[model samples]
Target: MDIEFLKTSILEFVQNHKSYAPFVLGLMTFAESLAFVSLLLPTMTILIAVGFVLAAADIPFWQAWAGAVCGAFLGNWLSYEIGQRYKKTAYELWPLSRNPKLIARGEAFFQRFGPWAVFLGRFFGPIRAVIALIAGIFLMPQVLFQAANLASASVWAFIILAPGAGLAHYVLW
Candidate 1:
C-alpha cells in the first residue's frame, strides 16, 4: 500500500528470484519511462534498490542494463507513437490535462532542446514522462528521436542503477 512497503516488496522479490533481476529491472524501467504510467509508479526508487540487490547478489550488471535499455526504449517509443497518432488529443489526456504546468514545462523543454530533449529530459523527473510525447506532438524526425531515445535510455539506466551497484559493491567488500 505504502511506497516503502511496495519498494521493500519489489526488492524482496528481486532478492528471492535473483535470476529475474534483469526482467524486473526491465519492467520497472518500462513503467518509469512510460508517459502517463510514470506518474503512478515508484519505479525509480525500486530501480535503485534493485541495483543494490544485483551487486549484493553478484548478478552481472550488463544483463540488467540490457534489459533496462530495451524496456526504456520501447516505453518511450510507444509514448512517442501515441503523441504522434493522437496529436492535440494527447493534451486532453487525464494526467496531462490535470497538470497544465507540467505540460507547459514539457513543451518549453522540448522547444528549448529540440531532439535532444528526449535525451536530456530522461534525467529530469518532471519532464521525463512527457518530453517524448512532446517530441511526437511537434513531429520530431523518427531517426533522430530513436537515436536520442536509445542513447538516453542506455545512459539513463546506467545512471539510475550504477551508483547503488557501486555503493553496494563497496560496502559488501
Candidate 2:
C-alpha cells in the first residue's frame, strides 16, 4: 500500500535484473505517457527513481534512455491513433468519460497551441497525457504530429532520467 515501498521494490527489481532494465523502463514510460493509463499509473516519479537505480546498478544509461524514448513515442502514437479513430468518443471511454474537464483542457490546449501543443505538452504533467488525443481528435497531420512527438519524447526522457543519473554518478564516483 505504501508508494515508497512499491518504488523500492521496483528499484530492487531493476537492480537485480540489470539486463531487463531497458525493457522495464520502457514499459514504465509507456504506461506513464499513455492516455488513461497515464492517469492510473503515475509512473513518472518511479521512473526518475529508476534512473537513479539504473545508474547505481550500472545498467547502461543509454539503453535505459533509449528504451524510455521508444516507449514514450509509441505510447503517444497509440493515443493519437486512438483519438483519430475514436474521435470524440474517446472521451466517452471510462476514465476519460468520468473526467470531462481533462478532455476540455486538452481541446483548449490543442486549439491554443496547435501542433506545438504536442511538443509542449510532453513537458507539462496534466496536459501531457491528453494532448495527443486532442491532436487526433482535431486531425493533425501525421508527419507534423510524429515530428513533434519524437523530438519531445526524446527530450522528455532525457529530462526525466538525467538528473537521477547525474546524482548517482556523482555519489558513486
Candidate 3:
C-alpha cells in the first residue's frame, strides 16, 4: 500500500475508534522514542496526523497527550537503562552498529551539552532517539536524567500534538 492509503486508513481507524486513539498514539510515541526502534519506525508523522484526527473526531486531547508523554518517558527510560547496563556494547548492536555516525553524533551531543542534552535533545529528531542512551553510557546521574526526561517528555508531547490539535479545534469547532 501507498503511504497515502496508510495515512487515510490510520486516520479512519482513529476516527472510528476514538477511545483507542490515545493508546495507539502512546505506542507510536514509544516506538518513536525508542533507540534502535525509532530509526525503523517512522511514527512521528503518523503521530502528528493522529493529533489532528483526535481533535477532528472530538477525542479528549488531554488523554492522548498524557499517553504520549508517558510512552515517551518510558521509552527513553528503557533506553537509558539499556545503555547503563550494556555501555559501549550498545553501539555494537545491529542498526546502531550500522549507523556509526548517529552514535558519534549522539555521543558528541551528550558530551558537549552534558545533562542539558537530555532535555534539549528531545526537541531534535535524530538526537531525540539516542540522547538517552548516550546519557546512560556516560553514567549520568539517574536523578538528573529522570528530571530532564520527565520535563522534556511532557513538553515534547505538547509541542508535537498541540499544533494539529489546535488547528483542528479552530477549524472544526
Candidate 4:
C-alpha cells in the first residue's frame, strides 16, 4: 500500500501483460491532460517509465505514441467542454479550486496570445490543462480551439514519449 510499492507493482503488472501497454499509455496520457487529475498524477514520471517498458518489451514506438496522442486529445477536449459548460464555475472545482492564481495566469496567457495560447500551452507543465479550460471559459471559437489542440497534442506527445522509447530501443537493441 505504500506509494513506492504500489508504483512498482503497477509497473510489474503492466510489464507482464504486454497487450495492455497501449491502455496503460493512454491512461497515463489522459491523466496528464485531465484538469484536476493532472495535479495528482505523476504523468511525466510514469510516461518515461512506460517508454522504457515499451522499448524493452518491443512494443512499437508508433503504437505507444498513438495511444498517448489519442488520450491527450480526448482529455484536453473534455477539459475544454467543462470550461465551456461551467464557465467560471470550473474555478471552484477541486483541483482548480485551490489554484485561483493559476486560472488567472491562464486567462492572462490566453488574452496575450489568443488561440495560439492553446497550442503553446501544450508544452508548459502546469499550463496545459489550465489553458484548455481557460479557452473554453473565454468562449474561444470551437474550430480554432480544436485545431490548435490537435496540433499541439501531437507534437507534445512525440516530444515527451519518443525520446525515452527511442533511446532505449537504440541502446538495448
Candidate 5:
C-alpha cells in the first residue's frame, strides 16, 4: 500500500543480498522500461535507490551496470518486437487503447525525430514507453533500432545509476 515502504524494502533487500544487486537492479530497470510493465510499475526511483544500495553493498558498479543495460535492451527489444508483430493493432492493446494521448505524443515524437526518437525517448517517460514500439510499427531499420536501443540503454542506465553510485561515496561514507 505504501510506495515508500516498498521502495525502502527493496533497497534493504539489495543491501542485504549483495550478490543479487545486479539481478535486482536488472529486473527493476527491465520493468521500468518495458511497454505495458513500464506503465504499471514506476521503478526508476527505486532503481536509483538501488544504486546507493549496491555501492553500500560493495558490488562492482560495472557488474550492476551491465545487468541494467542488458535488462533495458531486452525490455525495449521485446516491445519493438511486439509492435512489429502487431503494428496494425498495437494501439488496440488494453492500456494503450485506454490512453490515446500517450500514443499521440509517441507518434509526434517519433515523426519529428524519426530514428533518433528511439534514443532520445529513453530519457523521457511518456516517449520512452512507446517510441520503440512506434519505431517498430513504422518498420525502422533493425540495425538502427538496435544500435540506438543498446546505446540509449547503456547511457540511460549509467545516468540513472551514476548519481546514486557517485553520491553514495560522499553521502553514505
Candidate 6:
C-alpha cells in the first residue's frame, strides 16, 4: 500500500481499538529500529499518525511512548548482538552485505564521533542501524553504548511521536 493509505489505516486502527495501540506502537518501533528491516519499513509516517489517533481516541501518551522506547531499545540491542557475534560476516550477508557503503559510512561516522554517534545516529534513519552495528563491531564499551542507546532511543521516540501527540492533543482538546 501507499504511504497515505498505510497512515490512514493505522490511524483508523489506533482510534477504533485502543487496547491494541500499544502493540501496534511496539511493532512499528521495532520495525523502524531493527537493522535491515529499518531500511525498508515506512513506519515514521504511520507512527506519527498513531500519535494523532491516541489523542483522538484518548489513549495515554505515556503508554505509546513507553512501547516505542522499549521496542527501539530491544531492536538495536539485537542488532548490536548480531554485530558482536557475526563481526564482518554479518555485514557480508544480505542487506548490509549487499550494501557495503552502509558499513563504511557507519564506520567513518563512528570513527569521527566516537560514542556520540550512537546518540546522534538515532535521529538519522539511514544510519541508525549501521551506527549501532558499527558500535558493536568496534567493541565499544557496553556501558557507554547502553547509556547512549537508552538516551538516544528516548529522544528518538519522543522526536518521532511527539509532534503527532501534540497536534492531536491540541486538536482534540
Question: All models: lDDT?
Answer: 0.87, 0.88, 0.88, 0.84, 0.87, 0.82
Collision count of model 6: 0
How do the residues 46-70 of candidate 6 rate in per-residue lDDT, one tens digit apiece? Answer: 8877677787777888888888898
Q: In candidate 3, how many Å is residue 67 off?
A: 0.4
Model 3: residues >4 Å from true position, as ranges? 1-16, 171-173
lDDT of 3 by residue, 1-173 (tens): 69878767866776788887777778888888889899888688778766788887778889999999989999999999999999999999988889899998999999899989999998888888899999999999999999999999999999899988999867646
Candidate 2 residue spans exceeding 4 A from truth: 1-16
Worst 10 residues of 6 by lDDT: 6-15
| Count of residue pairs whose backbone atoms collide, per candidate | 0, 0, 0, 0, 0, 0
Clashing pairs for model 5 are none
Go through the candidates in order and give the C-alpha RMSD of each one to the true structure.
3.7, 3.3, 3.0, 3.7, 3.4, 3.4
lDDT string, candidate 1, 31-115, tens digits: 8889989987758887887678788777889998988998899989999999899997998988889999999999999998898
Query: Would you list the clashing residue pairs of candidate 4?
Result: none
Clashes of 5: 0
Evaluate model 6: give its TM-score.
0.88
TM-score, predicted candidate 2 vs. hidden true structure:
0.90
Task: Name every residue pair that clashes in candidate 1.
Answer: none
Model 1 misplacement above 4 A: 1-16
TM-score of every candidate? 0.90, 0.90, 0.90, 0.87, 0.90, 0.88
lDDT of 4: 0.84
